[model samples]
Target: MVAKQYVPATGDIVWLTFSLQAGRKQAGRRPAIVLSPQSYNEKTGLALFCPITSKVKGYPFKVILPPSSRVTGAILSDHVRNLDWRVRRARFEMKAPRQSVAEVRAKIAVLLGSGMSSG
Candidate 1:
């Protein structure tokens, strides 16, 4: 009998990839930074939103990070910028999968460090 290795629950940790999309004339733009989720719903693949004030609108963008394979920080950031600054939208599909706990943690640390340095 072979024993299967246990995979950590999706709620453990995940990364929300983001991207920025400009006008119709400028499509396929590069993504920005990634957001790290503390936990997520394994079955539903739902991630918590990180609150951030928008520079252009002066309102907060509730970014909903989903469980996907190719979601990057840039993609997530872009989506937030496109929102109306109020109300949540339907869950969208992620181009990538979720990152592991370690990967998420590392990315978060890097983001924090960079943020602190910039500030």
Candidate 2:
């Protein structure tokens, strides 16, 4: 039997390893929000994620997810990262609320100096 490959969907919260030390970078195995769409992940084998930290610092760039999302962490929109699932040990936890994901995307767009209309 062949091992199944992991492909996370947009707004899906997943736990992944972010090992290797880096100054001020989020490390260790923690829950992260998947920002890439399913099609993109399937084609590229890469998943875009905004790492979540349970420590909420009240930064404007961070969006706090409600407990309903099964996570009580602040989504660091400024810390969006893309990693190969095959190496990162990404595992699906739960799909976050669409509103929460939209909030993160809006923050990320602003960080990138782009506008995301709330339509």
Candidate 3:
């Protein structure tokens, strides 16, 4: 008997949670594309860690691609896509009515956690 694997469907929002090998938690979520059944050369995996800001937050995070992970190109390309998406989403969401800069900063801090930089 063969064991079945769970693969995410296209347009599915998946959360990628990470913790440092030494034991610190970092988590983020993004929409994923399922590329397994479509192409022969394409490997199976979900998009994770798509950054939601224009500039890199400088927080240390790692993407846990499975052992079976395979890509035709550089992994950084995937990272770029995730980062772009994150920034766009953040910008769109930050436009709240009558909100001050400080309020925005505080909100971001709360969402990203205390250690994350405001600027």
Candidate 4:
């Protein structure tokens, strides 16, 4: 039997093995926010996300997120990326509030200097 894949939704946080190391691009399991809409995930089998990290140093580009399932972190909008099951692990330990995700997306748009609305 094939294992089921977790379908991430916009505003949903998920745990994924993202590339953190520079040279070798080592896989680092971390939490990230799903930035793409459901349609994109369904049609392309790909997902867009913004990596979340605990290394917040009052950075202007980072958006501080509320604690989820005892995991406290901030969304690194500057490190936004796209991925598929090759790097995805599972959904977030806990889902974030809808409002929190919206705020994160707004911050990301500002960082990108794009007026594009969130999906």
Task: Give TM per candidate.
Answer: 0.24, 0.87, 0.22, 0.75
The residue-by-residue lDDT of candidate 1 on 20-112, one tens digit each, is 335522122222222323232233334333322222332222233343434423222323222211122223332233433334445445555
Worst 10 residues of 1 by lDDT: 80-89
Per-prediction RMSD in angstroms?
Answer: 12.5, 3.9, 16.7, 4.2
**In model 4, where do residues sit more than 4 Å from their true spots?**
1-5, 20-27, 114-119
Whichever of 2 and 3 has more lDDT, that candidate is: 2
Q: Candidate 4 vs. truth: CA RMSD?
A: 4.2
**Candidate 4 structure quality by residue, lDDT tens digits, 40-113:** 88678788887778877787767777654456777777767878834466564666677777777777778777
By TM-score, is 1 or 3 better? 1
Q: Score candidate 3 by lDDT.
A: 0.28
**Please, what are the lDDT tens digits per residue for candidate 3 over residues 9-92?**
322223333222345222343222221231221242322223222223334331223333221111111332322222323211
State which candidate, 2 or 4, has the greater TM-score.
2
Q: In order, what lDDT does every prediction score?
A: 0.30, 0.87, 0.28, 0.73
Native-structure RMSD, model 2: 3.9
- Report the lDDT tens digits of candidate 2 across residue range 12-36: 8999999766686689999999998
> Candidate 3 at residue 55, lDDT?
28
Who is ahead in lDDT, 1 or 2?
Answer: 2
Ranking by lDDT: 2, 4, 1, 3
Which parts of model 2 have CA positions greater than 4 angstroms off?
Answer: 1-4, 115-119
